[model samples]
Target: MNEIISGEKILVTGGAGFIGSNLCEVLLDSNNTVVCLDNFATGKQENIAPFLKHPKFSFIQGDIRNLEDCLLATKNVDYVLHQAALGSVPRSIKNPITTNEVNISGFLNMLVASRDHHIKRFVYAASSSTYGDSQALPKVEENIGKPLSPYAVTKLVNELYADVFFKTYGLETIGLRYFNVFGKRQDPNGAYAAVIPKFVKQFMQLESPIINGDGTFSRDFTYIDNVVQANLKSLVASSTSVNNVYNIAFGDRNTLNDLVVYLKEYLAIYKPSIEKVPVIYGSERVGDIPHSHASIQKAKKYLNYQPEFSLQKGLQEAVDWYWKNL
Candidate 1:
């Protein structure tokens, strides 16, 4: 992957959350002066505690919903990796008002701040959930269906705002449509926890994981490292007009059943008896997309996104983390 300019001042909104925290660490390692902005509404302090002592890292406890906080966090920043937003379809379904307040309104606040600061580029987290109800196997950037839940709507609005910001204000922006991203620091305890981490935690505890469907539903399951690479490439891409969206994924599909089997195998190294922990079938989740896969050709051609970790390889690392951390 191409490297972002070393020592560039970068502001990472929501840098205390799963994907954001991971991105901040990578950016710091690349020798950038990183500023992390988060309100801890959903972000965890422990996620960013390790970097507190790093000379290149600075933390700003703030909310994107507040324009002043956004301005404070982004002052003199060269680039903005806008990752702050409320996530979870079920949660959005339960309470879309709050999701929109955070995901949409807060996003607008950040864009205004980034525009005012004249940041070099703005790369924000878009989602596969934006493909809602579109039965296409390999979701492309151009084609999109109506959003199924409020969360999908929130993510879709980010893309729309990003495109408009680039066109109207001449601010360069790129949206990465991530598909099923998972890794260390991705919280596995919440009611809205992701499948991989949640399953790994359950298996480690000798508890049967509840699959939300018949184990046929599948996803691309992009690893966090690949996502971090995508963010880096987005920052350094040289195209004249980057007002576009790229699907960041490994471009491989695996059924939920396949995922559990691999998790069992990998976790068996830590606890030999975990292989026997069965997965219980439950009714499919409401508004759940039956299958999700991605076409990474666009990202590969434009952003030089070459994913190195497959599902099994990433799962092994995640299992190792949950084994020791949990």
Candidate 2:
């Protein structure tokens, strides 16, 4: 396994968002100088607030959509972890044009800037949505079905772009196809908020959380720390690991009902009344698959990636954080 010990100056685009901020925090703690580029569109200011005065950490208030900003951010950087994108399937369904402009076009801008600047490696955030309509039990890297939504299309295009960048410009790249990641600092108030944090918030407030479908739908819910490990490993992995996408997950699946049980169990510790909180059922979301599981074997064999947090372990940590923070 490769570890980022110190001394590398890395640029993390979208470093104000949940995942990006976590990456920034870890890098800084490892004594690596970090430049965070974010427009605060979907990213929160509070997420990056603590790093404001750190000597080794710098913030660039910019959008990836602009080639100039991407060029500026990648300058003199050893590596680029590109996490800037408009996420959420429903958000893409509602405003695909903006999603395309940000996720696809913005991704291209970052690629060009990284290539031009001669960055050592570019590790980017790919999505499990790229699996699309495939019915595979544990989604492998090569077997992908057609994209089901604009968000999925954008992520798939990112893989294509990264592949071309590596082949055409010799810009080494690794894409991490993240599963349904959840953990601390994840916003739970938005319309497109992730199920885990959203439910935690609802339960904290003694409000009923709505579960789409009959609660049989399942997903490979990865923890943020696991994702952070994957990103750091991608940064330092050998040449053989570059130019390929790996599924970053815990290699397990759980239904919505299962998730609810865990949430209620964890939160009931904070407030015993939360145990009786009712869950409402609603229609299944469009662009949603019935089940999602990941094959992390490739990641382990190639990058020596080993995830430490299971869904239950991560949920306990998340519930604790939300209990104190929210």
Give the winner by lDDT. 2
Error (Å) of candidate 1 at residue 23 is 0.9
lDDT of 2 by residue, 143-253 (tens): 999999999999999999999999999999999999999999999988889999999989999999999999999999999999999999888888999999999999999
Supply the global lDDT for candidate 1. Answer: 0.91
State the number of backbone clashes in model 2.
0
Superposition TM-score, candidate 2 onto the true structure: 0.99
Which candidate number would show the highest TM-score if scored against the true structure?
Answer: 2
Residue 57 CA displacement from its true place in model 2, Å: 0.6
Candidate 1 residue-wise lDDT at 130: 94
Note each model's CA RMSD in angstroms.
1.0, 0.8
**Candidate 1 lDDT tens digits, 266-305:** 9999889998987899998887888899999989888888
Candidate 1: regions farther than 4 A off: none
